[model samples]
Target: MLRRWISTLLLGLAAAALAGCSSTRLVDGQVESFSTLTALPAPATYRIERLPSQQTPAFEPIAALAERALARVGLQRDDAAPRLLVQIGVQASSVPRHGPSAPYAFYGPPWAFGGWYGRPPGVFGGWYGPPPWAFGGWGMGGPTPLYRRAVSLVLRDAQTQAVVYETSAVHENVWVSDPAVYGVLFDAALNGFPAPPHGRRQLRLPLPPPAP
Candidate 1:
């Protein structure tokens, strides 16, 4: 029993050590930008188009949030090259934190320590005995959850028919269970893009200093 107790204690300590690594975060920031809105006539009404071939569930909420954001930025929605073309594309998925075949174990007190059978004084006056029934076995344990997501949104110029700017935002430490959060994040990302004038003239968005 005493032996089992020691074993169980060690196992528990190990498990606690592992639990320290577990972490979670909701709605990491987003990324976004637009073409030179200043060059084009101020858009009054605009059209929001769903990106071609995107089937993920995160799309709708992102679309709704983007529409509100564009409206706030003074661009209207239009489909037939009226002014600006707003398009939304998204991808969401999870990757396991642990390897596929990770091992798991059970832990409990030793049978002799306080478990099933206690060691009464042995023949030579030594204490020895089998573990108690209450003592548990190893190899029995529960599973844990790990989830993550990668999402992207893009804005283009309708008349020029070119991607004025595109943004790819990642929410690393989240389960992405709620779509509303995606929309909220989309709004926040839209705010991150500065006014068109601040964008890169050729590629737009502050040019990264020449790659070292």
Candidate 2:
């Protein structure tokens, strides 16, 4: 019986490997200056706003999450022009039985011989990208079998309403009747931002060539 079980496990592992290989890509860093950037001119008073959410209790959890996150970076809500304002909102949807769709990578071919050329790689290569993992079963077409869920937190400039920061954390659990879990989700979103001295770090984008 043990031998049979071992054989079955190995087969399952092989099947998963065949279905897809895992890979990660770093998002482009867009922040030019973390230090001066995260620092606001010291607002006259800090204010927290909760965007309307279907979950009535979501706002409180979001507030707690923001408070903790701000404290970590040596910011307090009471300060004035007080330089910054935070908005927190929560979004939940029924476990749709499918995971999120992954976007494709765009790789411009080298301009060799004065022009570009190449066929886009297929899904299996993931050079094209991961196939949409259905929540309950296979691709989007399959029957729902599992749960799909996520939460997001956003930060914006008080004056311009331009988003200066944001973060999201996801989990595959049903979104119902769990206040503790919601708070934790907010914390996870807070983890998405850089703190204090670390905040000064800039996202390094490829610099353009200097004029000839």
Candidate 3:
């Protein structure tokens, strides 16, 4: 009886570990842009404009987070005669899950997880991209509902009003409310900045812990 109990305990512990490993929140999506420029002009001041579609009060905090991210990419906020205008938008929607294919697979092409090009090879090291069917696989498992939360950042020339750069980050999960997750998304959105990676790719960022 004692031996059987020990085996059961070990099994429980292993199961819990696997659950923790698989429960990670993954942000996966393609970033498409029209510009071939490799980087944004240096030392440019920007102003944030919230679209009418994002009029909710909850967006105030997310906007602040986006500002911080923009700063990280060397863009500053200048309301007075700003050189660049940044339009921020966010949306959340319920997507139908079909078959056993993972959610990420459904959203991106098969080569999304293959490899990274454009910049250098080692710049994205130490970070793990999405796994095969990590989100949810089609036909392999029953239909599991998932929510997609996406944020977009668009940079335009303040004077010309011509869009210079735009990118978006998308995440899939059962439910997401943590603000830090948005930070990760914004970072991914601005990964390549004015010059983004060519073609469709799966940009992976570490999931932030839930807010207390």
How many residue pairs clash in each candidate at the backbone level?
23, 20, 11
> C-alpha displacement of 133 in model 2, angstroms?
23
What residue runs in model 2 are displaced by over 4 Å at the alpha carbon? 1-45, 52-58, 79-81, 96-149, 174-177, 195-212
Ranked candidates (TM-score, high to low): 3, 1, 2
lDDT of each: 0.43, 0.40, 0.63
The TM-score that candidate 1 achieves is 0.48
Q: What are the per-residue Cα lDDT tens digits for candidate 3 across 2-72?
A: 99999997788678658865686665655554554466665589988766645555456678879998998
lDDT of 1 by residue, 120-199 (tens): 21111111221111122121332222333333455555667777656554443313333443444555445545343332
What's the CA error at residue 62 for candidate 3, in Å?
1.8
lDDT tens readout by residue for model 2, 1-212? 99999999778867766663333212222121122244444542446654443234423544564576566555577634444566554433332333466332222221101011133211011111123332324443554432222345455567887766665544443222223333444455544344333332222122222225
**TM-score of predicted structure 2:** 0.40
- Among the numbered candidates, top lDDT falls to 3
Q: Per-prediction RMSD in angstroms?
A: 19.9, 16.7, 10.8
Tell me the TM-score of each prediction against the true structure: 0.48, 0.40, 0.65
- Superposed model 1: Cα runs more than 4 Å off: 1-26, 30-41, 52-62, 99-145, 194-212
